[model samples]
Target: MLTYTPPIAEQRFVLQNIVKVDELSGHNVFADVTSDLVDAILEGAGQFAAGEFAPLNRVGDEVGSKWSPEGVTTPPGFKEAYGAYVEGGWGTLTGPTEYGGQGLPLSLSSVVMEDLGSANMAFSLIMMLSPAAVEALKHHGTEEQRRTWMPKLVTGEWNGTMNLTEPQAGSDVGALKTRAVPQGDGTYRIKGQKIFITFGEHDLTDNIVHLVLARTPDAPEGTRGISLFLVPKFRLNDDGTPGEFNDVRCVSIEHKMGIHASPTCVMSYGDRDDCVGWLVGEEQGGMRAMFTMMNNARLNVGLQGVSIAERATQAATRYARERVQSAKAGSASRESVRIIEHADVRRMLLRMKALTQAARALAYYAAGLTDRGQLGDADAQARVDLLTPLVKAYGTDVGVEVTSLGVQVHGGMGYIEETGAAQHYRDARISPIYEGTNGIQAADLVGRKLGLEGGAVLASLLSDMRAGAAGEAPLMALIEDCEAVAGHLATSSTDDRMAAAYPFLTLLSVAVCGWLMALQLRAAEREDGDSRFLAMKKAAARFYLDQVVPETRGLRAAAMAPAESLFGLDEEAFSA
Candidate 1:
């Protein structure tokens, strides 16, 4: 069995030096968070994830979740482990202090999330979705709604689930048919079926709060008429206790390829035409409100990719070190060598490490940006917005690649169910597809992020890269190439520009990741001791720049080309 350990030191370095988390100390919201406090939190979280959560990973996968006509039940020990997690205050790490939360910066929370995902991603989804619900309430809910739900949610006494995807409507919200008819008592009667709802109806919590998207009776056709609602599985009494059943029931659970312990439910609302729900925000603004949670979910999904890749890398690296195979070429002795001694195996392992580290840096850097957007300097917030889509899209895409590589490194064992590497590969597949697919993320990168402030954010980012080079010959050459690409991308017309958007986004992500790694290398050089850390950073950065950054040349050309090439490709050519 593979034992998972988080690279906490690397995470801390990224948070402290690359993202400058210390600067957030002065902010009113972040005044309580200090470096020592954050470190302590991470230490405890790392230990718990490795010791407690990780042990259940294989067991949960083997036993899986059992679904009956009554409800879904997780594997044994999950309930206990989750209780310990909540008791430790891990669930409320990033919630607002006013609502029974620890009020820590999301950067710190994200590090903990990475560890949890590494241990067991299916288990982590429960906590992940709850905070998302809290965020939605915090942003758009009425004062009454906040007062009623925030404390329970933030305290983890009750869990939450996002109810968006239905059987008929998966990605296209416009096709949703869930109906919420207005009632006389400032509530709505909701009737619909929701599928693939994680933690949809679990016995782990006292109650489940669902942030459901449904259409009002008067709602116009399409997404414009969608409204957000707060529907609880168990109704709350006047004294804040669990009351009558709210008419929400889980009809079935999906038989998934991975993450079996986490229930993916098909829930039917208002089977009795009595499911009561409260309006979250103004009527017909559900899509806007949902974006608040969607953005967070998207970023976290990217972290899922990072977490799985890290776990897979750890497992593969350990296997390579212990598994003996054929001798090296031209060896005098016939004794077998460890697999890691083989050139091909080393190459595979190195690629795994390089890609995983690069993705980690990117994901953590994005977390820092999210924190900065909320608590950093003005210019920092701008950079965070620009990088959000790239981080979410690119990081998760890389996650699928890296985790897949992990399985490949294991050879035949990787394909077998018992080896566990296959699970990482399967779980990671959903990350790039869900929470908005990578393609949608690319579209968002070009459609919204790249065009922000008429492209000033990207321009400023390029300028910062140039400034970071500071006349160093090697760095300067890379900076000059990146600038040239940026220049070409900047001048392209809209029709021609759409053709380049995806590749441009890819280039921008690789360039930014390379820049961050380079900075890490320089900082590691100046520090005393920990030469291994610095050396690894330098090697990873070198690999990224030498191998990965060159891909930008092709991306740049594609972005700068006329639109005809993409649009002109015959549809029939894509057929077999």
Candidate 2:
């Protein structure tokens, strides 16, 4: 049935030890955040996730969300689960204090999100998109706009969605044809169709605030002409309550391979030619405002990878321990033993555990850095810009790989729908493709991020890796490889850089992950308490360094491969 144990202990280890989240308490922003508070938050969230969300995962996937002209109906029990989530104040974790929120660190909220996503990945999307909208409005919206919308959105009474994709404009935001004409009053008449909008239409919240991108009548062509608008499903009254229908219609929802409970809607704005929206920023500043929301989502999407992988790993491990299969290779007993006793099964389980922990560390580190950056650390912000793509691309990639391994661990039973292993893999497949496809993330890594601060960002990261490596030969070698390939791509042509993007991203991500894991190992080793959890940390870190991190060597080679090899025979050569 795919039970999840919350992994609170592991999350604590990463938060307190690896990321040194406790250190953030010294800052005025996180002054009230004591270690005890962190522990209590983790414990409370863990219980809520296990008790409320875990049991509904199978049902959510099996029944999915039902759609009609009225609106989208979430699977049974989903509405109640969402109610509990809202009433419990779960969505207000990292929100601003002025808008009736707790104003906690992004790092803390990230762990809570990991727990929620682990319990129910499909259902968690309802909570994930709201805070991002709050962030967008907080950063780019006017004072009146923030006062009007931020409170309910922060409180989870309303949900938010980023409406950017059209039938023709997928990744290319410049190609969207959505129009927003100024209405002489404060609002604009918005007319467009947006596809693949997650949580676009759902029954969980009363109002859905859509941050949409459209172009003005006299706007220039392409992305420069695009502008962001705050459009709601129902127009607000003078008292800030949902009043009238705003012509925001859900034409239909998509039937997909995974996250069936998350409604990916084909949304039509101004079907009646009366939909009203307010400009978020300037007339042609949509891309800037949208990126604020997207960057937040990209990190959470990376955490989604870690969350699903953790769930899948636990499921696979539990099955391995209970399902009796074959005798051990060197055992004398003829009777069948648990599959976990088999060396190969042990190998797969270890790999899953190692990769899951590594990805979690990477994502958490990025989140923690975000908190630091928010506190006005310029260097931390620069480092964060570099790590965002790595966390997004590599973290989601690990989710897909680890979930696939979970299926392989279950063997024939994994293929059966009843076992629930298949769902994890299916759900994970979308993470790499959405929130900016992993390929685009990789391209961003090599093309843009690699050149941050005129190459100083990469250099700073390498210096940290060197310090973390602490003369460990394998880790040091991988760091050198990352540096070499990064240098090669710097001087390479556009085609060459694009060709090497994916591999370089993988290489650099592994190097950074290796450094983080090494830090965890050192922390574990230094602890005086001889606990089994600490022992597990040491082992996972060792395995990651010994086994997984070494893949960087080959990736470095691929990163350095000439673009000529890719272009030698381009058009129709394969068919010939």
Candidate 3:
């Protein structure tokens, strides 16, 4: 069985030291979210993850989820585990108080979510869509819609899903052809086949609320015509209990490479013209509404990446210490010793630890800013807007990188399916593809976010990074390099800027992560704690600064490369 230990201590260090979450005390909105309460929540969440979810991960991978005409049947223990999760109130942590939620700060939500992800990436995804849905409803749904749906979804008794992709419209959402025709009774009839819908047909909940994207007749072409709709698996009766049988059906579920336990359904709605749907937000406003949730989901996906890396690090470190190999170089005896004693093995372990810690710190920083945004900090929201793509792209890319290193650390054993190292690698491969492909994230960062407020958002963020890394030479140097590249982009051609998008996102992410570690190193240097943990923290920071931070130089070079670099190899030359 695969083993995972939740890094709750590291989470606390980030919360109390780097995030300084205690300062949110003045905000009445978070008045009840004391440090003690937050710690207790993390503690309980960690326990639940390790004891319940961890055991089911391997089971989920082997058995996956089964489907039939009745609906989706999850692997053994999933239904019971989800019931326990709701009973423990895990789902309602950051939800609104008017509903069944506890109204905790978003930073706290980030902390618990990391544990869930580390425990079981596939299992956690079942409920991941709900919180994002809650955000969408809170921001865009009608008052009656919130009253009718928020409670059940927030309580975790009912799950939520986002349906944006169709057979022809993978990431090009503007090309979707699903239609929602108004029937004149305030409801619309939806007709379309939506694919890649995660947890679309699951037995874990009593009912599922699907947020579907479709075009209305007389609407304009392209994304301008898109509108959002709320289509439930089962229609609600006047008493608010599920009543009529909806026309939505799961035509089939895909056989995926990773996250097999997560049912990715191909749903066909209105097969018999009975799929009742209600409009959300307004006509021609689906893109605006869906982004409300998609952005949040992007952040969550980044955390998924961080969680798997952390888990892989734990497994690798454990395997290194236990797996004996030939004696270290120049050893007095020829007897075998633990692989951890080998220099290259130590380097690999440190690299894994450094990458995971840096990525984790970056994620928590974004989450803390998101919490501040909730408290009405306009500047913080702007910062979060800038950090979202960095978190999603860099974080997941690192996830794939780190998990692959886990397999390397295991040697031959890692390739064996029973060892489970390969599963982490397989699972992480999808993170970079889902939640708006990292390429799109990079494009958004370069084309959209950088221009926000006439470029003040990016400028303000660089200023903050400089302040945070005032005395840290490496981080400061990276910040300066980033500033120069960003400045150059203002005069660069559209092709040049778009060509630089991916590298620019990566450069900014690596630099920001370095800044965060510098802040963490300074804090650990001044704070009182176990000498070993503090020393380890400092070493991790130094490792990232010395090793990972240098990647920015390469990123800047690639990002600033001539636009012709990519197009020079034209239509006829490539295939030959």
Greater-lDDT candidate between 1 and 3: 3
lDDT of 3 by residue, 253-313 (tens): 9998999889999999999999999998998999999999999999999999999999888
Which pairs of residues clash in candidate 2, taking residues 3 or more apart in a chain or in different chains? 228-286
What is the lDDT, from 0 to 100, of the residue 245 in candidate 3? 80
Q: lDDT of each prediction vs. the true structure? A: 0.82, 0.92, 0.89
Looking at candidate 3, the ten consecutive residues that score lowest on lDDT are 550-559
Q: Could you say which candidate leads in lDDT?
A: 2
**In model 1, which residue pairs have backbone atoms overlapping below 3 Å?**
none
- How does model 1 score by TM-score? 0.94
What value does the lDDT take at residue 26 in candidate 1?
76
TM-scores of the models, in the given order?
0.94, 0.99, 0.98
- What is the Cα-based TM-score of model 3? 0.98
Better of 1 and 3 by TM-score: 3
lDDT of 2 by residue, 327-371 (tens): 778789888999999988988999999999999999999999999
> Least accurate stretch of 10 residues (summed lDDT) in model 2?
527-536
